[model samples]
Target: MSKPVLIAGPTASGKSALALALAQKTGGVVINTDSMQVYRDLHIITARPTPDEEAVVPHRLYGHVDAAVNFSAGAWVTDAAKVLADARAQGRLPIFAGGSGLYFKALTRGLSAVPPIAAEVREDVRARLERDGVEALHAELAVRDPASADRLKPRDRTRIARALEVVEATGRSLTDWHREGLPPLLPPGEFAALFIAPERDALYARIDARFDAMLAGGALDEVASLASRNLDPLLPAMKAHGVPALIRHLKGEITREAAAETGRADTRHYAKRQFTWFRHQLPEFEWVMPGDARGWVASVIPGREANPESRDSGSGPSDHPGMTWS
Candidate 1:
């Protein structure tokens, strides 16, 4: 069987395009590794593959969950394991693609086995954090779960609240559950992975242009519908890169122009963070610039030509011999 392909990159870095091209050539199925794209309500805002793209190649796990659901990395890993097995059984390559570093990491490495916390528990912790402030919560965590407190910053409201919730709900520190993690779905030496790295300035330009295009493509209406639902503001979908800003505009807190600018800035900052996270957390993935990714992927897959015409032109495989796929 061919090795499964994993394509990870920052937003607007052409990850989906690369996945689609390779899948078309290899008879593969594209599986989503993006956190935002999983929401059914976020098709346009998340830049999900359109129906036309999905019709070209088999796609799995895209827009499968509701925006109100608190989908976690562990949940995605479980879903992905089933999809990976089905694809392998059918003799099709599984092309995992997206920019969510944590989701990708969970697939390639084991994830913490923290059990689900009740909605009430999560809401209570969030409420306490808001009422008593993060520092107060940090102090409480320091007393209850000092191990977590010592590792978390006082200003880290999310982590602080999470630690408190786990301790409160399960009577164990978050670090304890982390020590007992689920095995990796795709362990080392089992998959071929690549991270797309584009020129910083060019990437920023694409991000800006894409945000403008999203605004034109009814992203505002999408956010407006989501805002009307009165879902929890802390849900991941609610805080998607542009959602909060667009919601602010809908609430008359900001002008449309200002919302668009804020969304653009937020996406650029997120792209920068993705670059850093993947570099530091997933060092094993081979990094290729946008122009070279297609050649790099083709080179790693057996019986595939990087460029068919080059075979007769007296040119050899693209000079990316440093990367090896097992």
Candidate 2:
């Protein structure tokens, strides 16, 4: 079986384009590792591949879950395991592509096996957080589970609530459960991973241009439709990069120009965060500039040329002597 190719990069870094090109060349199936792209309701806003793009190659796990469900990393792992198995059985290369660092980490490094938090307990903790604020929750956690509280910041509402819920429901600290984690789906040296590291200015320009294109392509309409559903504000889909600002625009709280600006800023910030996260969290992934990415992949995967005309054109990795691979 061919070693799976995992392409990770920030938003607007051409991850999808590279995945599609590789998939076309290697008879591979592209798998979604992005957290937002899983929601069926978010197409334009999430920058999910259009139907035409999907038709180019076999794609799995995109827009498969309802936005109402609180899809977790664990759930994504479970779904991805099945898809990976199928790809291996069919003798097709699995190309995992996306910007979600946590999802990638969960796949490569095992995730903590924290049991499900009861709905009532979860709701109660969230309600308390809403009423008493995150500081109060942190104080409570400090009294109940000092170790977790020490590890978590006071302003971290999500982690604070989760730690509190775990302690309340199971009488065990979150750290205790975290000590035992599920085994990694793809262990070290079993797969080839690459992180695209484009020049920051160029990437930021691309992100801004992409957001404008998305707005022109009816991102506002998509957000309006999703907002009409009145799902919980805390839901991941509701807080997607552009969704919140667009929803504010829909509510007349912000002008369209302001909303667009906010969306672009948020996306740029997210892309920056993705770069830092992948660098620090998954250091094993080799970083390559945009122009060199295709050539790098071609080198790692035997019999796969970076471009069909490269040999004739004499413009391959051999020509660019500065290409870095570690």
User: TM-score per candidate, in order?
Assistant: 0.91, 0.91
The alpha-carbon lDDT assigned to residue 169 of candidate 1 equals 98
Clashes of each: 0, 0
| Residue range 1-326, candidate 2, lDDT tens digits | 66899999999888887887777666678999999999999999888888877876679999999988778898999999999999998778899999999999999998999887778888888889999999999999999999989998889877888899999999999889889999999999889999989889988998888899999999999999999999877778888998999999999999999999999999999999999999899999999898889887887797653333222322112211233222
For this target, which candidate reaches the highest lDDT against the unseen true structure? 1
TM-score of 1: 0.91
Q: What is the clash tally of candidate 1?
A: 0
Give the C-alpha lDDT of model 2.
0.86
Q: Candidate 1's residue-wise lDDT over 155-181, tens digit each?
A: 987788889999999999988999998
In model 1, what is the error at residue 223, expressed in angstroms? 0.2
Give residue 132's lDDT in candidate 1 (0 to 100): 90
